[model samples]
Target: MDQKTILVAFGGASPEHEVSVITSHQAIAALQESNYSITPLYLTKNGRWLTGETLLDLKNFEDLKKLEDSCTPCTFGQNEFGQPVLLEQKTGFFSKPKTTPIFAVIDGFHGSKGENGAFQGACEMFNIPCTGSGVMGSAIGMDKVMAKTICRANEIPVAESVDFFEPDWVDHQSTLITKIESLEYPVIVKPVHLGSSIGVEVVMNQESLIRAVEAAFKYDDHLLVETVITPLMEINCSVLGSSRAQRTSVCERPIGKEELLSFQDKYLNDAEAKGMASADREIPAKIPDELTKAIQETSVKVFKLLSCSGLARLDFLVNEETHQFYFNEINTIPGSFSFYLWKESGISFTDLLLELIDIAVEDQNQKARRIQSYDTNLLSQKAVKGIKGLKSKK
Candidate 1:
């Protein structure tokens, strides 16, 4: 069999772009060249798509201007036969277009358009297999309010939250504040669709609540306000596999030095402290056996409920005083692909990457079995009466 070509796409138009870059580099390094060919696709902050040898080097990213100049910008679109093609400059005077079979796409994108299902929809249109959740799952998981709604429907324990649109908050400030005040103090205010703890504020008072809401609105049109769980211990578990079969990795207790896991504490500070050596975590979190089992089970349920495939990390906040656990959020495209957690389960990073690719191919094949089009053309049989005959006679 011919070696499958996998596109390790990263550095999307999201706040987590730099983190995605590091993730893609790690994946590219772990991929086995014998069974698959790796192509690095970089999505610039300005939304330009580029692919070239320069993207593979992590050092190139340090100098953004130079890296952008070195990479050849490209565009992706379907060809005459409905095959995906990449159009780029081949030479100084001539342009070259190439159409390579993308066996699978490993999405290292974290948030925004990339993680919010836009990229997934594009990949689906091109009939390319992609790792992680599909359109519905990605969109739902990215939006905190939507995820909470789904969890509530599924009887999953989630922190009580109130969602408000920016327009409503701006127009009816007093009403919104009254509604928010119904919940106790020390609430968490989050943007509807962001990750890496960006625009997440823990408000301990009414003044902070108002300020947090204002800050959150700047990041997204919708905001989620939830009562903070006192004496909170953050626990995270990685769930892997498709809807049919899934497994939960050993739980990790994330310890942060602040009131909440701030953006800097989660990524920037950790990166500066560890230099990619290891992420700060406590593997197999020090918790009771029953509590561990419950968290693991809930993690698997959330993964399947969200229709997520490939991999995802489910975060939870456990109240130390009450011993209550509440689902925090889900990361469809978790940082570093949650390789460390899987590694604890005896899966190497290289093996995990290969497994994800295999899952993507299998999922794509399964989807192909469904019938997408009808043999008859309904438009041809339609009349121009414009619902004249559709009126019901009472």
Candidate 2:
């Protein structure tokens, strides 16, 4: 069998671009290089795409000008067989065109175009299998408000939230403020279309709410304000598989110094400070067994409810005083793919990647089974009639 070439796409037009680069590098290192051919596709912050041997090195990213010069610019297209093809610049004038089949797209995109459905839609347009959630799932996952609504409809427990679009906030600031004040103090303000806690802010009072909203508005037009669950303990659980068949990995408790997990605390903090290596998480969460079970069960429920595929990490906030657990968010394409949690469940990173690839292929096959085009062409029948005959109906 020919070795399948996988496009490991990383870096994106997101605040978490640098983080995506690190995650992609980790994935590339874990992949079984002997079994599959890897293609490093780098997406710049400006949205330009490039690919080359130089991208395989992490240091190349430090120097943007040198990195751009070393890599060949590329774009996505379809092949003759109707498969997704990657078009790369030819090295020499006499050389034949170089293209490769994008067997799978390993998405490391964090926000907007990456976490949202843009890349997923592109994959669907070309009928290619890509890792992570499908278009609808990706879009819903990126929007916290939408995810909460869907979860609520499915009887899943989520925090109460009020959403405000840009126009609504601009036109009815008073109305928006009234709605927000009703929620409670220390409400969490978030950019509706971001991930990895990029534009998340915890507002302690009306004054802080205004400042947080102003900061969050810089990132997205849509915003979400939800009552903060104080005395909170953060627990994250990773789910693997599709909606039809899925399993949950061991739960992890993120030990952060702050009341809420900040972007820096989640990603930048050393693991030793909180215990555990790589990202500071306690495997199987030190919480009561009942709480652990509840979190795991809820994780699976949310994954299936969202129609998430491959893998996703669901975050939860447990109020220490009340012992009430509330859904925070779901990361369809989680950073580091939440391998640490899965690792405790006896799944290695390499095995996890293989499993994700298998799930993607199965999803694509199922989609292929669906009937798309009819045997008879409606256009042909229309052409048989005269132009005047068609114009008569109009």
Candidate 3:
């Protein structure tokens, strides 16, 4: 049998651009040992879509300018047979552009449009199978305020937070500050729609709180200020499969330098080649088995509530003293695809990726079974004539 082409799509105009590159490279390396043919779909910071063999190499990313210059500019389109293809341009006058059929798309993106359903919408338009959460799930997972609200409504414990847009802050600065202060000092401020700890800040006092909020607005229009959960222990669990049938991986306790985990702690500190998998964390987190069971169960609940599919890592903040935890955030297209957690759960990295592809294909097949359109034409000449005749009688 011929090898199927799995388009490993990543990189975007977000703060997590470099991280996404690392993730895509990681996925490509694992898939290389598999039966499927890997195709690199690199989206530059400026939003240019390109693909080529050069993108599959991790070393090329060190100097992105030269690397992008070596890639072939491409876009999503269909071939003569209406099958989805990655169309690339040719410079020569007589040479026609090349077209490669896409069997599926591996959503390896980290933040921004890549993980927030925009890219998923593109895949749906092109009628191609893409991994990870669908549009609704991706969009909600990316928005912190929305995710919290939904979880709260579902009786899931979430830290109390005060959310406001940039305009709300600008117009009612004092009022917003007062409301946040009610949550008390030393709160966690976050950009509502960003991840990788890009604009997350732990503010102790009012002065610091104002500064943090201001800084966070630079990355996103909306911000969330939640009461700090000190004596805090950050535990994360990865959920696999779809909303219909899902399972949670072993819980992990991530170590941080300060009260909160910074971006440096997650990817910059000991990161070598594994991306998020390189982050310092304790697998089968040193918590009671009972607590671990609770967290794992909660993780699966949030995964299904958010309508997530493929794989997602759910972060939770636990009170070290009380052993109580609150659902934090969800990484729809988690960095390194959260293969590290799955590895500890008895699934290898390659196997995890293969599972993601299988889930994507299954999702696409299920969608195909749905009734999409009607058999009768509402815009037919007979229909139009009847409508005109009725109008005349009226």
Candidate 4:
């Protein structure tokens, strides 16, 4: 059978770069056995795109710099027929670069420009099929403040939050602090655009809040401070498909050692580095059946609300005592694609990935069916002739 090349793109210029590598390798391992031809598009931490057979091995990731040196630098280019292809850059004087046609792009990236819609927009520009949300969904999902705002508008339960930018804090630090404190002490401060709990902190007083905010600013200029739910149980559910149809996996309650799950708690605990799969979580979350159902329903709701597609894991903050769950955030490109959660629903990691690819292909086919460009010549010669009569604002 003729094989379509599926490009697994990962490792971005983000704080979660290492986790992204692990996620990509896991995906590569699974997709290798599929009918498609798997190609690795490794994005270096410095924002360079490279690809090679060596990138398929997880062990090669131990020395990122050395690994990068062995790969061929590549970028998205169009074929003579205007189809997107992974074009390798010129290496040596006599080197003949090869182009690999990209049938679909598996978004293995975790954060920053990768998860925040920059990469998705690039795929859109090239008319490439990308697994995960489109530009709007990815952008909104990356912003905690925006996600919460949408939840709040939709009457979805969410913790009371006060969000501000660096300049806002600089201008009115005391006022912002006062507003945060009003939500009461023991509040959680988080970098608005970060994940893996990198710049998240729970503080009981003004001093700790100040320090947390200052530190979080390093990860993101925008910050969100919200009341911390005491006896909080973090429940996460993975959603599949787009607005046309949707499904949610069994709920999983993450077991974090600290006040909240940290980057170390999520990825570094395992000697093998299994990404989010190795992290401790109670599958089918031992919560009440009704609560599980509620979370499952909410997960799909949030997924549709944010315009997410392909796959996403929605995390909810549940009050252990009251069992009142609040929409926390959505991971558009969840680690390991949250295959572990789907596995509980009778879906294997490989099957989960295959389904995601199927969804992406269907979405692309539907997109192609739409009327893309109007035939009207808005920029005809007559329009260009009038440009000289217009005055400059300056």
Residues 1-394, candidate 2: write the lDDT tens digits. Answer: 8788888888888988877888888888889453778898888889899999999888778898899898898888877887788988778989955889888878877777977889889888888788999999999999888899988888778888789988898899888888998987879998988876777888878788888888889999999999888788888899999966999998888876777767777677763222123566677788888888888899988888888999999999899877799898999989888888888999998889988888988899899999988786655856668665978999
| Candidate 4 per-residue C-alpha lDDT over 1-394 given as tens digits, one digit per residue, 9 for 90 to 100 | 6799999999989999988988988988887789999999988889899999999888888888899889998999998889899999887889867888899999999999999999999998898999999999999999999998998999999999899999999999999998998999999999999999998999989899889999999999999999998788999999999878999899998897974998888998899969998898898799999999999998898899999999999999999999999999999999888999999999988998999888988888898999998998768887766664464432
Report the error of model 4 at residue 392, Å.
Answer: 10
Give every collision pair in model 2: none
How much lDDT does each candidate structure score?
Answer: 0.84, 0.84, 0.91, 0.91
How do the predictions measure up, each by TM-score? 0.91, 0.93, 0.96, 0.97
lDDT of 1 by residue, 1-394 (tens): 7676788888877777887787778888888554888888889999988888888888889998899898887766666777665556465556456656667889999889989999999888877889999999999999888888889899998988789999999899888888887897878889989988888888878888888888888779999889889888899999999988999999988766774777666666644422122456688799998999999999999898888999999999999877799998999999889888898899998999889988988998898899988886444536424344566432
lDDT of 3: 0.91
Supply candidate 2's per-residue lDDT for 263: 79
Clash counts for the predictions, in order: 0, 0, 0, 0
Candidate 3 or 2, higher lDDT: 3
lDDT at position 147, candidate 2: 91
The window of 10 residues in a row where model 4 has the poorest summed lDDT is 385-394
Cα lDDT tens digits, model 3, 1-394, are 7788999999989999989998988888888889999999999999999999888888888999999999999999999999999999886899999999999999988889999999999999998999999999999999988899999999999999899999999999999999999998889999999998999988889999988988999999999999999899999999999966898899999887885888888898763776787778898899999999999899989999999999999999999999999999999988888888888888998999999999999999999899988898887999999999999997
Between prediction 2 and prediction 4, the one with superior lDDT is 4
Q: Model 4 segments beyond 4 Å from truth? A: 92-96, 391-394
